[model samples]
Target: MSEEKPQRKIIHVDMDAFYASVEQLDNPELRGKPVAVGGSETRGVVSAASYEARKFGVRSALSGVLAKKYCPDLIFVRPRFDRYKEVSNKIRQIFHEFTDLVEPLSLDEAYLDVTQNKKGNPSASLIAKEIRERILAETGLTASAGISVNKFVAKIASDVNKPNGQKTIGPDEVESFLEQLPIKKFYGVGKVTTERMYQLGIFTGADLKAQSLEFLEKHFGKSGTYYYYAVRGIHNSEVKPERTTKSVAAEHTFNENLSSEIYMQEQLQAIAEQLAKRLKRYELAGKTVTLKIKYSDFTLQTRSKTLPYFISDKGLILETATELLYQERMKDSVRLLGISLSNLNNEERKTVVVQLRFEF
Candidate 1:
């Protein structure tokens, strides 16, 4: 008889409207208001929009102009990335308490491999609920969690109930769920892929599964095999830790789009302070500082410069970031502004020396 291996347990957690939520949480006046962490205007793109703004079709990465069309009364505000990172760290600390198998996907999302956890918890669903609750309790923010037997199902499950909700995809119900899953809901099926799939009559998991493996492979290459198995709830991906993180950033959206250079520089200053805090917290230093800007029309632009050596000093990073911001030509009404540090250098691992003794 063959020995049975333990099942893989993965959990996916994502912040609900991360940037916008942070903005709303910090200022009581901002709550329930149509707030966006991007420039307010038709020139810049929206970086992050609150739930209230989203009702008007406002969304992240949309041009400020389009956002206004969706919600004309939308109030734009500059991004405060520094504050967001502080909140993110608090959330990360909470994840570690349950299990060390954390893999941060971004500042806003992560995958946790809790198959064998520190707490020795039997059920992943319980752990997920607890984590979501803790996130709310600790950061005054809402998060959604997806618990499943593997990474693929876990990620999909997390999105099933969004904005302060939790969902579980048990092993038994995997097939039934996939059968009704719209192609658009599949992880990798983006706008371009969906349009193409629609034209080819691929609407749901059943539609996707009807195609032969050979045909899918012919079109999507190696990813085709993923689609073939993914629709059937087979996922083998692992939770990769963020030990390789090389940078940290902070950014903000504005209430009103600004074409004025002076105002944009002021926004950069705030973002720089926030970026510096994250760098110091992680004990990291970087040689490069980058400034990101978005126009009200949704056009994006960035400028970056590398220093002679990596440093974690706030003043130095801000100086370099400020320089980069100035170097760029202000062409349109800026809706969003951001700052980030990269090309990191910090402490190296210590190697211990051991002595051996010979006895007679």
Candidate 2:
């Protein structure tokens, strides 16, 4: 007598504050103030913030001079990214109208699975409240969700009631909701693994389910078997609708600080023409071509080259990022410049897992 192996719904969807709420939804006098999309309160950073600039703690990689000293009426807005990818393709066409098993993860989060959908809905919390009310009635924007039973507790319950709101755990409340969560709200625990799980005292998920999977693989060696089956709710990762584009980049960050290499090959020819217009808008091509360097005391360097073919031109990515920016030299006074492309021709699309059974 052995059965039980079907429990997967998943959800995640997240947006709210996506590029400062799409610059306050296409500027209506930046609605209720405090916006901030990119940066320039005298330099760069802050790639998004709003919820009235996160109430004075203005986040998202902060520092447009400390987010104008933490919201001196912060209002910087300049990152349309093609109007946030045309409202992230109309909220991914309203999440494929219920589920093609989406998985996006950026342009503003995603990870649906719906455990058998196409609107014969069986409540993944009312299909994440009708996909956050049809992404606020077709992109006036405002989304947040997190139903569960996988994709790591629906990506930490889509940040428990953030901006808009949503949160479902069910399946008998996913093991006491991951045992009272908070190992820095786990979902790939960061900030250096939440200070190495608070120096091993593991601060919750019931202190990492009282250790030992051989003491968390002797202290997280393979993420200690993913915090031992994610606090025993046991995740079986899925919801992957073809996501593969390993690398294609472009960078600049230089409002001053280039101690000439003919101004770093004229800023690597405008970052290899914005990485060849993002590898010709994803018709992608690559065979390695990295060359990132940021100095002015913020020390960092990289130089790479690997090609026998694949290259998305812009004069061959500025002649291999100007031969790795003169194959390296001035280690000081640089301030950032980048270009990247990496062994890609974009293939790798074969993930089809469909296990059905649902109950919320």
Worst 10 residues of 1 by lDDT: 351-360
For model 1, state the Cα shift of residue 212 in Å.
2.0
Task: List the candidate 1 regions with Cα displacement exceeding 4 Å.
Answer: 1-6, 246-360
Supply candidate 2's per-residue lDDT for 257.
86
Q: What's model 2's TM-score?
A: 0.35
Expressed as tens digits, the lDDT of each residue in 2-75 for candidate 1 is: 12212577889999999989988888999999888976685767889999998988889888878888898898
Q: Quick one: best TM-score, which candidate? A: 1
lDDT of 2 by residue, 3-25 (tens): 23348888888998888877777
Give lDDT per model, in order: 0.81, 0.84
Query: What TM-score would every model get versus the actual structure?
Result: 0.71, 0.35
Best-fitting candidate, measured by lDDT? 2
Position 180, candidate 2: lDDT: 90
RMSD of each: 8.9, 21.0
Which regions of candidate 2 are displaced past 4 Å? Answer: 1-12, 18-40, 54-71, 75-102, 115-121, 124-162, 166-242, 253-261, 266-286, 290-319, 324-338, 344-349, 353-360
lDDT of 2 at 20: 80
